[model samples]
Target: MSEGTEPSSSSLALLHHHHHHPQQQQTPPPPPPPPPSTASPSVAGAIVRGYRKGNWTLHETLILITAKRLDDERRAGGSSSSAHCSPSASTPAAAVPRSAEQRWKWVENYCWRNGCLRSQNQCNDKWDNLLRDYKKVRGYEARVAAAHAGELPSYWAMERHERKERNLPTNLAAEVFEALTDVLGRRAARRANAAATPVSTLPPAPIPLSPPRFPQPPVIPTAPPPLPEPAAAAAPPTLPPGHPSASGTLCSPIDITRIHLEMSSDSSESENDDGAGTAEPEAKRQRLGSSVVRSATVLARTLLACEEKREQRHRELVELEERRLRLEEERTEMRRQGFAGLISAVNSLSGAIHALVADYRNGNHR
Candidate 1:
């Protein structure tokens, strides 16, 4: 057993079988590796992976978003010579207390302040996941909105809990939605909807041209009973001045009928006066309603006219700019032609001078 040479195959086989028995499989696995050095981000990342590898908690996510916003502000206002650059804007720098490793380590420290306990790598990973999920929710919302005729509902219009059977249409959680909204601002669709709300183009409801007619009282179809002869119904038989009827002490049939007819006419006239009184307020109300409608119409027309003028002004400016550019190009071409003509004239004069010099030389030689 203690020999230097390797053990025979049969002995090796027996040892392997003895150690790998099914009963031994129930034993616990080995302990995880010791935490790594923090000397480098690479090693630090490994330690984070080993320490706490799980889904981010909601409070931790909120902290991350808040910290990111603060970091951006601080970086944006930071001195160009010493500050780590904000994401898109930056200037030259030599060094600072710590490196801007992916511009995230400081944010990680911020999360740590809230007892988040996540490394920069974890923070980065979680942030990317949150964005990815947020985008997916946005896309789903867009698709849902497309089915309707008009603009989509705003993100903040509905509460987070109501977005599902409860929420508007997105199932994303309240914390995540709010965090993403704060970090990213409103989505494009939401912004567009908000922008379009003020420019309604449909004409205001048409105003009726004339005041409505008042309802006429129904006419009575049956004619009054034939009046008694004037002698009977018109005047109580000219009773003697001291007669009982004249003194109002008693009435004959003729006098009674005359009183009845006279009383009826008086009651009818009083009813007409009461009807006029009741009709006055109703007419005033109708006039008031019409005046309001007319004022609204005038306002709407004014707004439309202003909009048209703005569009017309824009068109004129665009046309003027085009004309200016065209004239500039033409002016450039004319200058180019003028320079060419000057060069051609100079060459022609030089040729004539050469011919003249030749003629003079010939005559002198002769």
Candidate 2:
């Protein structure tokens, strides 16, 4: 063969290796899971003579749960896609059905269509058991979170109080409730959020430090002008002493002093009226000032109370932060100690191996 026809060293090496070792066989994949059982309950069935009988498969349980959730959404008049019920992104339904039997029937129909083929009674019983287990798991999870937050003592006390109120603790293992909480946890979360309200979220009462603005009172006159008096009739021109002035009258003399006294009485009565009018307005202004002062005092008290509550909450927050920092420091110290012990252990193990090797070498020499 010519130089150009010669095989490369790398290709020749691969050929030789392949020739020395036969091709390895590929491995087969694992077998598929068994299909769902279609057998009905019988005397010899594992149901133990009770309708609860056979254990529900994971597939069947999921179908029942999904169907019930869909029915709930339907009742709520909400539009939700089937993908929402998938394990990766399961969401809470909008609402639960008010009619139990109707909800169960719908669940049964859905399960049947999806190849689960379970009776309404079976669906109802299984769901109830699942829900009860879900609650137990959730309660246990709450205790774990509380423990991590250093609140286990308070959490345990609360549980004891609940027991005294006739609420019993669950005995079932939390493992049995796995996969359940992942799907139903959102519903419980929604309910809790809806019920909970913090004091801080409340709107504060508006305080008006300054008194409310009132329309200014009109300026009142201290004294009113005197009332007009009737004018005295001019005495008949002194006609000849007794001439014709007494022609048809008995000549009665005009009393000038009586007229002056009557005019004086009218003027004094008008002055009294002006004085009463002035006093009335002054009394009204005094009443308005008193009421304004009372309102301002009440507002000041309310503002003080709000300030006290804010201070208390701030102090509590600071204390909590101190506790968290202390816990973090303790954890760091523990980690450092653990690492030191690990290093010491490795050194001791290396020394022991060296000692064993030395002993073996000495034995061979002997």
Per-model lDDT: 0.54, 0.51
lDDT (tens digit, per residue) of candidate 1 on 58-106:
7778888888777765654454323234534443343333356757978
| Residue 256 lDDT (model 1) | 36
The TM-score values for the models, in the order shown, are 0.29, 0.27
- Clash counts for the predictions, in order: 7, 1
Candidate 2 lDDT by residue in tens digits, 139-202: 6556767677654433234555554343324333334455555545545443333222211112
> Could you tell me how far off, in angstroms, the CA of residue 294 lies in candidate 2 after the best superposition?
31
Model 2: lDDT of residue 341: 100
- What ranges in model 1 sit over 4 Å off? 1-50, 79-102, 149-171, 186-366
Q: Please give the TM-score that candidate 1 achieves against the real structure.
A: 0.29
User: Which candidate has the top score in TM-score?
Assistant: 1
Model 2 earns a TM-score of 0.27
The deviation in Å at residue 111 for candidate 1 is 1.2
